[model samples]
Target: MEVLRTPDQRFAGLADFPFAPHYLEIANAGGPPLRIHYLDEGDKDSAPVLLLHGEPSWSYLYRHMVPPLAAYGHRVLAPDLIGFGRSDKPAARADYTFERHVDWMSAWLTALDLKDITLFCQDWGGLIGLRLVARFPERFARVVAANTGLPIGGGKAPLPFKLWVAFSQLVPRFPVGWLISKGTARGLTAAEKAAYDAPFPDERYKAGVRQFPLLVPITDAHASVAECKAAWQVLAQFEKPFVTAFSDGDPITRGGERILTERIPGTKGQPHTTIKNAGHFLQEDQPARLVAVINGDDAA
Candidate 1:
């Protein structure tokens, strides 16, 4: 593997993102070194909360909620999935895959020795993180799913997602960062916008971004379909604590929360909420509400 790491200078002076950077090198032979970047906040002894961001976004998405969660006495750890944020970016679109993503994150979690973690997963975060919990249930304590689902590739995907996949491939420019901003409800500020743009110095670093939309298993014949079905089997029996906090305005995945609430045994009694006014990027649009849900403040 030709392990590649993003230059530290790229992330300098990210406003309000004060957490120190950390890294883990996972096995990815015949490809890039697979550098995973993360942030560890609050006391190490406190209960651990793992914040996982989704596609086209990074740990930067959780800047607003980190401090408050830390203040409430939980150790918050947020990681920028490989190819996003300060993590290494592979040069080829084929280099990014569902199994590879799951393996890379699983290695990082193992290397960090994180156990009894409470997970906060959104978008691809939920897709990959939920698989981690299902595959390695012993390491997790609870899960909070927002704007995410576990798709097994046997059902029709929402229309918006299908259109998104088509547009991402057909578009000539593929403005990765700009497209993310537009997906959010209120958009981002100048500084925040700059932060999202910082990771990719050029289009070459966006191979993973461009490939992610295509990698989602949208049909029953997809490669990862069987594995996802197996993961769903594990999740079907999951009897721990699971809660859904989906936003109301996300056209792409508005009803995804129901899958977890209905299928996972863990979600039986937990309060599920539909956050209003937020779009696909709920962490950016409703960070305070997200935090409240995680802290059990909004339970009825």
Candidate 2:
């Protein structure tokens, strides 16, 4: 697999993203070992709080939430999945797959040997992270499922997601920053918007972005359908603490949290919330609230 690593300069001076990059080399399904980049901050010995970002975005999505989480004395970890951020980006759109992503990140987890984890997963983060939880249930202590899901293609994906899948494929340009702004309730500043665009120097660097939307299983014939079904069987047995914090305004995932609160045995009696005035990217719009949720101070 031919891979493209974004030049280091594009990431310079990214506003509110000051953490130094840390990397780990992990074997992939094929080709050379890929380098996965992550931000490891705060007390190294403390239990980990793993934050996973989703499509067309990277660890930059969690910048605001990181400082507070780290300062609260938890080891905060945020990784830029391969093909996004400073991580190696495979050249072809066909290089990315749902199973490959799961494997790559599974490798990352085993590499770090992280335990007692509190996961904050959004978008594709949940798609992949939730699978990890089902497969490695002992590694996690609790979970925060924010605006994401593990779909098995048993039914049609939400209409907005379907529209996004079509748009991502047919659109003339994949505007990463503008796409992020459109998803946030408060939107982003010019600099913050630029930060989101920093990972992709040009269109060629966006193969992962271009391919992510199509990976969602909106039909029974999709590649990862059976895998997600097996994951669901495992998830139904995941009895650890589970909670959902979905935004009130996201058309794409507004009602999707019920899938977790209803299915996960651990979600029973947890004070799951619907964050008001937020959109698909709740971390951007409600970082403080998210932090409070993480600290277990969002009571009432």
Candidate 3:
């Protein structure tokens, strides 16, 4: 496992992102050393809110909400998963796997000694982050899931996800940043678009992007199915507080909130919301509404 770390110099002067970078070396030359980058905001002793981002996006996805959450007197920690943002990027598309992603993030959590955490997960963030919660429930305090799910691939995937999988495989250029903006209801500004594009300097840095779509467990027989099934077993028994705040316009994961609401015992009686005027990238389109959900003030 050869580890490749992107230099801090490569990420200098990103717009609206001035948070200092923190890295953890989770895996090493005994194999490939996995480097994970994260942003730590507010006082370290404050109650911790763990924010996780999904495919093609990094911790940068949480830029807008970080300050508000910090202002609310909670510490915020957002990590750039291996292969995204300022973290180490593996060279091959085959290097990324669902289980690997879980392990990468789980290691980061353990390294940071984060516990009793409130989790805000979206997109792949939910998929990977939920697995962390399920496996290590003692570490989590509460959860807010948005536009994400833990799919064990037992049935047909939603059509939009299937189309995305196909498009990711077939597209010649695989516009990493453009796809993110277009997937949202309001779209991104030229500056915001450039922020998303900052991580990948060229095609070489996009192995993670190209690999992420294929990593979704689309069939029941997928490799990570057993682990996800185990996580589901744990989640079924979860009695902690859980909430869902999904965007109304997200065709890709519109139905995922129902899975958490119905399956997780913790979701009972919680104020779940469907944010209007937002799409798959709800955090980008409606960050304030997302903050409202975190604060438990979204029209409960």
179-235 per-residue lDDT for model 3 (tens digits): 889978888888778778878877777888888887777687677988898999999
Winner by TM-score: 2
RMSD of each: 1.6, 1.0, 1.5
Per-residue lDDT tens digits for candidate 1, residues 165-217, read: 88878887666567777878888777888888888887777788888887777
- Cand. 3 TM to true fold: 0.96
Clashing pairs in 3: 1-32, 27-33, 153-220
Local distance difference test values of all predictions, in order: 0.85, 0.90, 0.85
TM-score of every model versus the real structure:
0.95, 0.98, 0.96
